[model samples]
Target: MKLNHSVTGQDQGLPIMLVHGLFGQGRNLGAIARRLSEQRRVILVDQRNHGDSPHDPDHSYAAMAGDLAEVIGAFGGRVDLAGHSMGGKAAMHLALTQPELIRKLAVMDIAPVAYAHSQNHLVDAMAAMDLQGVVRRSEADRRLSEHIHDTGLRAFLLQSLDLKSDPPRWRLNLPALRDWMDRTTGWPEGLPKGIFDGPALFMAGAESDYVDDAGEAAIREYFPQARLLRIKHAGHWMHADAPEAVAETLSAFMGGG
Candidate 1:
């Protein structure tokens, strides 16, 4: 399917595949990938329906997992996988569904359980932007500021905007994303029983609500061998917020050091 990816480092070592969160592209993890590249091959993948990948009506973890498997197959099978938020959930699904394709797994700041509908404000803010009349990216930023007060969040969302020869346009499929909002926010149900016994890493931002003390039991249930790491003073985007800490943790886990 020609899934968009950014590869770094030497190709000889164990390949590490990165999957980004909702509203994020492969480039979101570019910094992390570059750092990890020194010792390992890193491939940052843009999940379907999000970045430069093909868009489809299907938005569930099952479909996303399959898409991940396809990408892995293209890479000659077997990879160390790491994901954040929605991508984290998808990585879990991939590990559980296609165990053979994954060497080890890392899920950042997300539990296996279905998340509540808390992203409504973000969705509303994106939808409220008049895409048709948007002449400049700055104007879009101004409009987003009315609904999303956080400048960081507004800037993160606006990264998807790009200029084409004809006119400025949004690379993301906003309408499809909006339609599948519920599916994206929620987790997939009904896994056959039994945990993914392979090595797993569960990383959470200490200040993030995405993973809490109460969620540990469920996370352990699915990933029995999973080791949890917490990055202090970081929010949902821990990898970006604390790249050095995240990189250290990931390197240790990957190397079994």
Candidate 2:
């Protein structure tokens, strides 16, 4: 599947591709992408079934990784890759299966191991939302609030809701995401734990348990050269929680600083 992407900076050096997490569009990483684009080419892509990309039923990492491979191939077949959450898994899978396609890798707030948690509840909330006659975002927010209490998360999720359409609708494939929640939250079974011996950085949020000791060990097992860093005063959404710090850390790492 061809992803909808936006490029920044000049055609110099290996381009860096930024992939966003679940329910997020490529623009979610706009701050980091813009910062990194100052020195290198930055490509922000919307994975399949999200943003303006084509919607498909399969949301497996293998399929997501394959989609990313196609995008990377278009940009000289190699790239410095970074992904958050689900996107992180996709990037890791790509680096493991097609090591040559990645020059350097950075995974945000995630590990190579499968996670037990699922984001299906959020999908259900969105699916249950009443978009009928929802002429404004506040209406949708009010309806979603019945199920989701987090105001911030509700806003974030609403970013995918298009109010300009004839009837307000979500850009995300809610059905597919809900159906494939299990696969999305898991690592592919039976696949050999291949290694990616490239420069890899696993940036974890200091307040987030997404990358714990076990997660760090798993990361090193797959990427021996992986360096782990923890950003202060941040949670799972570390980039948004600490944009400058995350951007600086990524900039220095990608520049071999």
Candidate 3:
């Protein structure tokens, strides 16, 4: 599947590829991508079934990882990879399955283990919205309030709504995403034990339980060369909540790794 993407920066050295969280487009990480682009080619990608990417029935991590592989093959042979949330999970799967294609891996606010948090309701909430019936963003916002009360979260999800569409369409394949939420939150089944010896950075949000001391054990086991960092005043969406810290850490990894 040809995924939607945008490239920035022309400086030499290894390129950086960034993947965004669920319900987010590649441009979600534009700020960080632009910063890294100053010294390296940065490719911001919109994962399958999201953003402008064509919708597919399957939404497993393996499938998502494969889409990323196809993307890298088109851009370059290998790259420094950074992913957040669901994107982080896809990055881990790609690195573990194809270590040669990745020079270094950076996983933000996610671990190699299955998450206890259930985001299915978020999917359900989005699915419940009748985009065709709504004519204005305010009505959509009001309907969304029935499921989500957080202002920031509503804004995030609403970004996928194509307001100008004749019938008002969603950029995301809601059903596919809803069906795959469990798999997205769960680690791949029967994955090989091959360790990615290449350096990896696992950044956790200070307020997010996505990665904790117990989870670090799994990360270290899968990526023996992995190191952890915690960004202050952030939640599961650290890249959005703490852009400067995330960019600094990513730049350090790209330059030093």
Per-prediction TM-score: 0.93, 0.97, 0.95
Ranking by lDDT: 2, 3, 1
For residues 1-257, what per-residue lDDT tens digits would candidate 3 score against the true structure? 78899988874677789999899999899889878887888899999999999999999998999999998898667889999989999999999999889999999999889877778888889888767678888898988999899988998999899988888888999889888878888899777654688989999999999898778999888888888999999899888899988899899987932
Global lDDT of each candidate: 0.81, 0.91, 0.89
Clashing pairs in 1: none
lDDT of model 3, residue 198: 90
Best by TM-score: 2
- Model 3 RMSD to the real structure? 1.5
lDDT at residue 149 of model 3 (Cα atoms): 97
Q: What is the lDDT of residue 127 in candidate 3?
A: 81
The total number of steric clashes, by the backbone 3 Å criterion, in model 3 comes to 0
- Quote the positional error of residue 123 for candidate 2 in Å: 0.5
**Tens digits of lDDT, candidate 2, 94-114:** 998989999899999999887
| Residue 63 lDDT, candidate 3, scale 0-100 | 90
True-vs-predicted CA distance for residue 65, candidate 1, Å: 0.7
Scored by lDDT, the top model is 2
